[model samples]
Target: MRRSGPAVEQLIGALIPRPLPRPIPTPAPLPNLPPPRAPTGPNRIELDVARLVRAGRCSARTLLHQLDWRPEHRLVVDVADGTILIQRHPGGRVLTDPRGALTLPAAPRQLCGICGGDRIVLAADLTRDRMTVYPMTVVVRLLAEHHARLADGRRGR
Candidate 1:
């Protein structure tokens, strides 16, 4: 014989383990906020694309002008993560020509795997007084990685 009643429910409830009650959620503490201030200098970055010449030179006059980098200004060149970086420094080997041309050194160019006729991305940070050069090869590689990640995410869904 089978039984269906409050007594049966109580017997089953007693036999089965019950889940623990959820804890009451407490609100997180608010962060201390600083007072807002007025804008002072150029807070935006400038970007442009220019072709690398066979002589290891590129023209980014507009970006240079924005950052107040003039002809005869010395620059330090460096390569990091397949990208070239230029910054204003004392006693730097590289210099801005009278015609506003930036001559990159052969070593940095070779290290970054960029050659003549390649389109490069020039990013000028006015506040930081720095310029970053991204070769087309690096750009393509970055794009490919991003696309691969997107495809993986779609597959997961």
Candidate 2:
């Protein structure tokens, strides 16, 4: 009965009710996470990492200082994928001499944790914490050599 324009405008208004837009709430920065913890129980690789860190093969502490590490970052050993992915904070950045660091993130993929495989044997300087991984290949090679040395079964003490 009434004008069509009024009815159409009413219908459109009902469909889309506009409101005064407010600024999007920015996400609060997440807290820093701890570095990858050694898996429960002893692991030969973990032991090796500790040894290397102590020996200064990798500057774990220095790297953490550089990254400003926190508890939020996690270091995980994914045996299934045969990789160690370091999950760092989104905004966090790593500062280092990439050339001096022989990161296993290069060719020959499964290098010594010092050189290959998913477990980055390099020193990760997080804004929260620090961690280290020894080249898996290096570990494998060392293991193989030891096994070979024992090939004769107690041939040499």
Candidate 3:
């Protein structure tokens, strides 16, 4: 039987040199930086989600109020990039209802693939005085893209 006695330990210690203790490192100081500036632009947008009612009507009273839209206000409804854009136009044929509910035109709604009872995103651009409606399909695509970018460790648009 082999025994690991002090004699064996002494032999091992003679074969290996003991290492010196390492000094703890001090952390470096943080660099002085300027304060973050306030966001400045004419593209400040407010976002809301609402369900489209029957007859292509959707309730967006808060967004409309933010854009300063009032009853009888003329609005132009159009579709761009599969999203519905409602803008205040002097020659617009559509009018805001008395109760501030928006009656989206059937043509534009169809173009954006929006249907009654569908969930929609209302993005109101305060400076532009316009509201953009994104159907569920568009919203899903956007969210998918955003998540994909995040997974890839990249910034989302």
Q: In candidate 3, where is summed lDDT lowest over 10 consecutive residues?
A: 2-11
Give the Å shift of residue 81 in candidate 2.
Answer: 24
Per residue, candidate 2 scores C-alpha lDDT tens digits across 4-99 of 564443357777888989999999999999999754443322222323332223334445445544334433322223333333445533333333
Displacement of the residue 138 alpha carbon in candidate 3, Å: 0.2
User: After best superposition, candidate 1 residue 138: deviation in angstroms?
Assistant: 0.6
What TM-scores do the predictions have?
Answer: 0.68, 0.24, 0.71
- Pairs with steric clashes in candidate 3: none
Ranked by TM-score, top first:
3, 1, 2
Candidate maximizing TM-score: 3
Once fitted onto the true fold, the runs of candidate 2 whose alpha carbons sit more than 4 angstroms away are 1-130
With candidate 2 superimposed using the best TM-score fit, by how many Å does residue 44's alpha carbon deviate from the native? 12
- Local error of candidate 2 at residue 65 (angstroms): 15
Q: What lDDT score is found at residue 126 in candidate 2? A: 39
In model 1, which runs have C-alpha deviations exceeding 4 angstroms?
1-43
Show where candidate 3 strays beyond 4 Å.
Answer: 1-40, 154-157
**Can you write out model 1's per-residue Cα lDDT over 1-157, one digit (the tens) per residue?**
8576656323577877899999999999999999896555776678899998999888888998988998889999999999999999988989888787778899999998889888899988888999999998888999999999999999998
Q: After superposition, how far is residue 27 of candidate 2 from its true place, in Å?
A: 66
